[model samples]
Target: MDFTAILGAWIAVGLTLFILSFLYRDNPLFKIAENLYIGIAIGYIFSITIYNVWIPKIYQPVSNRVFTSLSNWVPWVSKFVTPAGDAGSLTPLFPAIIGISLLTRIFPKISWISRYGFAFIVGYGAGLAIPATVATMFIAQIEGTIQPVFKLASGGAIDLSGPALWTSFSAILLCLGVIVTLFYFFFSLEHGKISKKVTKIGIYFLMVYFGAAFGTTVMGRFALLYGRFFDLYTYRTSGYYHATPILILLVLIFFFVYFGKSRKTSP
Candidate 1:
């Protein structure tokens, strides 16, 4: 019931309507809102870059050392002092130097120097990813697929006379299907007739798997769209100022369509 709160609620309703205007058609109002959103996002990113990364990691460390040296306040200079000279309380410069080298990519003339930075980053990323991919996707998946289908009791024995045999056989078949389907894509050597037949079966399984994955992705996209529609509907229905921006957008779209039709009829 607060006046400020009521004003804020109305503003939210107007903004929601503006966003929904996109569904009707591309209008000046929607374009303005879209541009404002992009500008705000860019401003946020710039602020976050300075606060989170640049200031803390680079500026503060170097600035602190410089200030301490100028102040002539060597409280514990012995820790950082080396055999060559009193280097003062300063962090290692190698990381900063590498970071600077990465920034050189912004310049057209010295962009080649950034290749070392790219190589280092790529090499490190690949080194980590290769082992992780092998362990998780390859080894762990293989282990999961080939696990014992039988239920083991606390007495260190499995129920052998149950449905374990059938389950185990199915598991083995599934594992083989996945492996063979993956190998079917590799065309280094010519496959014989029997091998070709097996690979064709593998291809069918692979197709089914890929189709299911695509279907799932499509469902996920639809779900996201549905959620956005729900949000628009709920906000409008809450009596927060019923601005059916989508209706306006639809009107605009129909107007354009009719105008185009009229032009075509004249020709």
Candidate 2:
């Protein structure tokens, strides 16, 4: 590979080793890698937000508004103004004002101004999200749980030996799970012997759900670890000039020398 490509490969290998070193112990190498990753991620996200959101929605619309106004007085400026179809009018500037108000929190005396911006954001977000949440999480879930039972009952005759039996069984189990889980959260009524048993079933269902979710999350993290390991293995080849082996050797030597010196210097 070219020199630049080889250099990039070496840097990637070194950084990967630095991050992996954390499994042994937290040290300067791991901290350096962690901070570098965070800084780069923030810089990338900021650039993306600026280009994708701020420029298109805020800057362009506001600039077009100013240009359109100026063009009325100077005919030559009309050429700089974008088409009316793309101009979002001055509506975008209202949010831009609220966004700027958020920055006022940096000042001590005027920090209270930021509350208005925060209130608008919270109110607007809730207004948009609450209906969607209820529709999807509450209503849709109820519909899904009930729809299957309705279909199973409406079918002329029950077939215990066919897929219909399996479908009906699953639908009944799901309905029972939903009812018991909801009852488990119903604190108004005192839970008696029968109620306790129902709630115990709910507890089992919840535990299974939470365990499955946690397992899926762990598997995703391991997948990322595997990918990084694969890259580390690839860099061991001659095409990357054995960057992985050289870095690993350097890391081992550094650990031994540093710890050895520390032991001698200790009281």
Candidate 3:
């Protein structure tokens, strides 16, 4: 492999071993990996926010509002998307001003200016979220609960004969679960004898949900582990790759460092 590729592989192996060392104990290696991950994540997010959200939407349109000219050296996309007039430039000023105001927090005296930006962000976010949340969390969920559950037959007829029975049963269970869960959350109804039994059933459903979610998360993490091993094996056989050896070396190095640090810091 080229020097850069080999170096990257070594770094990746070191970082992975450092992160995995936490399974034994949290040590300097793990802390270093954790901080590095956080730093990289923040930088990645900031770059994406600037490129994806700020540049095209806030900067380009405002900077050059000229109409699209497809035949120009620039891509034809500019004609349709570029703002029509000076209004395009003016459009970005308000949000840009608010965004700049947010930076005032760095200066204690002018930090109050940041509140305006915060308030604007909060108000806009709430305004946007309310309708989206209602539609997605409430209306869509209710619609899903009541969704029809029959299949079409070979003749394009509703197949109520066989599979529909199972489908209908599952739908009925979902609807009942939703109803019972809602009732469980309804504080107005006193938890009397019958209500207690019903709420118990609701709790059972919730437990099953929580268990399934936890299992799925565990499986997802395992999948990531599988991916790392797959990379190690796949690339190791590629002749140019040395990830597996590097990984083993890092594992040894991390364990030694971690043990030495532990002994040094031990009371």
For candidate 1, list the clashing residue pairs, or say none: 24-249, 24-250
The C-alpha RMSD in Å for every predicted model, in order, reads: 6.7, 3.2, 7.0
**lDDT (Cα, tens digit) per residue for candidate 2, span 121-200:** 99999999999999999999899998455233346654556677778788998998889888899899999999999999
Model 2 misplaced regions, further than 4 Å: 2-4, 71-89, 150-155
Error of 3 at 118 (Å): 2.9
Give all TM-scores, in the order shown.
0.69, 0.85, 0.75
How do the candidates rank by lDDT, highest first? Answer: 2, 3, 1
Number of the top candidate by lDDT? 2
Model 3 residue 80 CA deviation (Å) reads 30
Per-residue lDDT of model 3, residues 50-97, tens digit only:
999898788777655434333244777664665544434547778999
How good is model 2 by TM-score? 0.85
Q: Go through the candidates in order and give the clash count of each.
A: 2, 0, 1
